[model samples]
Target chain A: MPEGYLRQSPLASLGLAARAATAADAAGVTMGERERVMLVNLRGDGVDRGFLDRVRQALEVDLPAEPNTAAEGTRHRVLWLGPNEWLVVAGEGEQLAAALDAALAGLHVSVTDISDARAVIALSGAQARDVLAKGCPLDLHPRSFGPMRCAQSRLAKVAVLIDQRDDAPSYDLYVLRSQARYLWRWLDDAAREYAVRIIRP
Target chain B: MLLITCPFCGPRDESEFACGGEAHIVRPADPAALTDAQWADYLFMRKNVKGVHFERWMHSHGCRRWFNAARDTVTHQFLAFYKMGEQAPDIAPVSYTARPAPRTDPALPADPALHTDREGAR
Candidate 1:
């Protein structure tokens, strides 16, 4: 197999300088981005066994069927957006899209690369939910929305897709590319109460 | 600040949902046979119920699905939120303040007594 394409991510300005810091170290919330993750929009007949099987073979992940739920595989993560639509998260977006296209050649499905369309910001720490609740209306309580759950809600004035990733009360906010800076600033202001820290991812 | 329950995404703030005016206004099957006045009625007329009403709403910020809803125009209480393909729930147009749970099946009951010409989105 050939090496993957050297596509430019929107956050390329940051240049991927590796660093790590925790909520404890930051005194409260640790805010950062997932950095260059691939986003693929997948739409198909979820009830069709053939389509589901081919999707699994292409991405090595089972398509999540439950509303606001996510399914993970070794190589990919899929979040259920609608009854028949999903957002596929991967590392190599173009390659994955091509592979899915080839694998399900005759299937009635749509696999489009939306990696450039969104920027995934990771907001984690003990008080992350509290920070999110400042403007978001979704029940971000641990008992209501916990790990493996994904929701689409508006943050500030823009629509975003958020999913609870790791259980440090960690959540990933996927906003449109144009709104990334505004949301970043919004989160910064929101997290000010908890003393949030930003680290390169 | 009404909390509308999106059938797919559970209850969400009314801010996240956009009302699509009246619902269940079926287009006449034989449009060519209707007169201009009848066509105007079909296109522009809508029942303005003060108590309970059938409407369409879109969870634009959430799952982005468009579903039907039963709401009281006067009280702004959402009585029922159902999927697009589903039938409108049965309601007796009780006072806006208090209404029992809507019953779903074939069709909702008609209540001409609830007429008032209430205005606003949905």
Candidate 2:
């Protein structure tokens, strides 16, 4: 309980800064940690217009109703986890959950701040898809999984939620906090063949 | 690997799914009134059929939603995928009765040479 305590990511002990500095400049894959992103689990009646409208008003973007899709607002990215379940990734802490709670005051919905439950690792570069293809069974072809698409699937045998951030084919792998180190190591080793640059956030 | 089509997430590898045994087993309203045998029958009895089987499957790795599927046990072919609480689709069941009939021929001895009476052997 120190007065000036610092928040550390699960992969903090990996010394990513030291590694990134010495990484080959011509690497095929660049990996980094998005340690400050906040996550919130939102579940409500997807069929209810009122519920949907309230959520849209709160987030300033429509929650993706289609499976495996994501909608990005100015501050949040809403990923559809199921028919009525979504995971909101926000750049700020706790405020998104508060906004959702205020918007859905009397509705039959659940909004939980799950920011500490998972860790997000950013992966992108020319050979990123090939590195993911080594273990994941999902069709990662751009035609199938373009930007703004997200999916919950296994990556290197670890359950992860993959969000394709852009046409650079960048992805954010959301892994359980307990398995973040293991998944990071797996990705590190998997990306070695393609030359990985471990970027620090 | 079998490609299972989740009603919500579409086709995914079988590894991403977990099979929840036989579907549509209703729970009794009053369990206390039922006899022990009746209770056990309701709890343990499962129709492990060989033909068109309706089962519950969860898209564990994908959407993590439970859905129903009609699959042929003999052929490992999925007949249909419907959402949970929905009735099984009415499709002409796959050919499950294609098992070859037992070898029967009048020309063959009633008991093949392999079956020898113990007394005859003595």
Candidate 3:
């Protein structure tokens, strides 16, 4: 186990395991948490080839050049937050932040380990899109948003980063730690009509 | 719902954006040398145009970047969106031919039901 602080999931008190077992009989929506994952915020000039080359050498994947897109690597996934900023989601035990700091040593860039600032909630299954579309105004159709695509938008009136994980149509919502509970309750209420399963992180 | 296009992130809902008031207002280089009236003018005065207003907007919930946009206040039609430090697009003076003028003609008859001759109707 890692530190005790990192061991506790944000939704620990929600009794999600029991709820998930009850809803397992149906197959509408499956919700889970990916707690204590490493989240690093990286910022550098996208136009600078040198910076891009350094990041690619470090992570073995080119930082996504397009807006609202994500690039997945063997051990890490980079989501584009802005033209010059990205969020690096890596395994909890990885030292990707130190590696990035060394790789971008001389460059005018930023690599901050904001691992605990946000909470990740996974929403999947058939009606996941319907549950999201109920609040988010983005065009979540397959053509507009698919696997590896990411967007920063409001869900249930709270700011969230929506990252589409795969064609299973799964999504990982990165919400501020302070508002994670509110977002969870909102999602639970919204997904009540569907077969809602809450899984452990 | 107004769909404002962020320069970096395509079009997004208006709820994701926050307007930063009128755009292209340069601050004076020498604030200490200016009179109170001049300083107040620069601080308080703003153009409230009826159409084709230039304004600054930030995609607060999205990219968190600021950009400029030209929009028609009357129609709420966004004319163009440009990144910061770029020149605002030059649009031809547009005329509003479809919008009707407010009815102020005295020749039009008033509704009789709206008027009553009964006293103490106050």
Candidate 4:
């Protein structure tokens, strides 16, 4: 095997970027283009302390120390997914997987780039929670999950990470890429109660 | 409802956790030297004690971390919770301890996402 080959994740081929949009629309209205981001799975026989440190050094971002909490920057954000897992999101066109893999190779960890493994759905509107309430049981009220708050919970039968960020009741739902169409249909059906326009990115 | 005391998150509904069965079972030093029956016993058998017992539970829906809990099997009451690698509290032993009857139906709500098999499924 080539010396640097193993250090690169295959998902690096897909560029990742953060998509931001305005939510000036009405109730249940969907504004802003949906953007896709990479979701990487990090695992090892044990916690790799040095690997985490190296990742912070390379990315110039602090890893989220609390579960369900997210750390964001101008171009990237890292969410604490689990004890040995994290979700790294960056702007589209960025080779994040390979960059992260190469940055933490000596730490005895396995990084599987999941850019294509998951789907990203961004919802912003007054009725965002109203739509989510149809499937999710968690309290989506702004007081419970305001900006920077995240939780790994169910969106109907599908597992998802729900991040509530915008004051306009906007939310970002993430699930396996294979379930994209299913979730989209569910969302569309749920949003029908209110006026919603699907914006393409 | 079964209210589990998370070592880190305080008391949370049992729905947030996954039971890891009985804890404190040490592995044999040389597994290769054991007989088939011995290996099978170690791998598949458990006491499933009815009284106070130590068990492992993962806060799958909360911190997404594993910890230990001292629970009364009969009452389904958690006596204490401890993080992984931490020692269980030292409780005095009582000779007259009685096994509490298992609660036939617990009121805890289910957390569907914690049981899903997807990546970052917690």
Worst 10 residues of 1 chain A by lDDT: A15-24
TM-score of each: 0.84, 0.88, 0.89, 0.71
lDDT of 4 by residue, A1-201 (tens): 223334332222332223222444555658332444556665543255676678777678877776567888666787767666777777656777788778877667777776666667878787888888888756666665688877776676777887777688777877776666677777877887897666644
**lDDT for each residue of candidate 2 in A1-201, tens digit (9 for 90 to 100):** 112246677888888867774635888999999977889999999999999998888888999988999998988889999999999998844478888898899999999988877999999999999999998989899989989899999988889999998987799999998999999998889999998888865
Deviation of model 3 at A92, angstroms: 0.8
User: On a 0 to 1 DockQ scale, where is model 3?
Assistant: 0.80
What proportion of true contacts does candidate 3 retain? 0.96
DockQ of 4: 0.20
Comparison by lDDT, 1 against 2, better one: 2
Error of 3 at A118 (Å): 0.6
Q: What is candidate 4's lDDT per residue for B1-122, written digit by digit as tens? A: 68787665556556667999987778999999999999999999998676678899987766678899898776677788888888888754333366656666557546556667564754
- Number of clashing pairs per prediction, in order: 0, 0, 0, 8
How far is B41's C-alpha from truth in model 3 (Å)? 2.4
Worst 10 residues of 4 chain A by lDDT: A11-20
Q: What lDDT score is found at residue A196 in candidate 2? A: 85
Docking class of 3: high
Interface root-mean-square deviation for each candidate?
A: 0.7, 0.6, 0.5, 3.2
Model 4 residue runs over 4 Å out of place are A1-25, A29-33, A42-53, A141-144, B1-16, B32-40, B59-64, B91-122
lDDT winner: 3
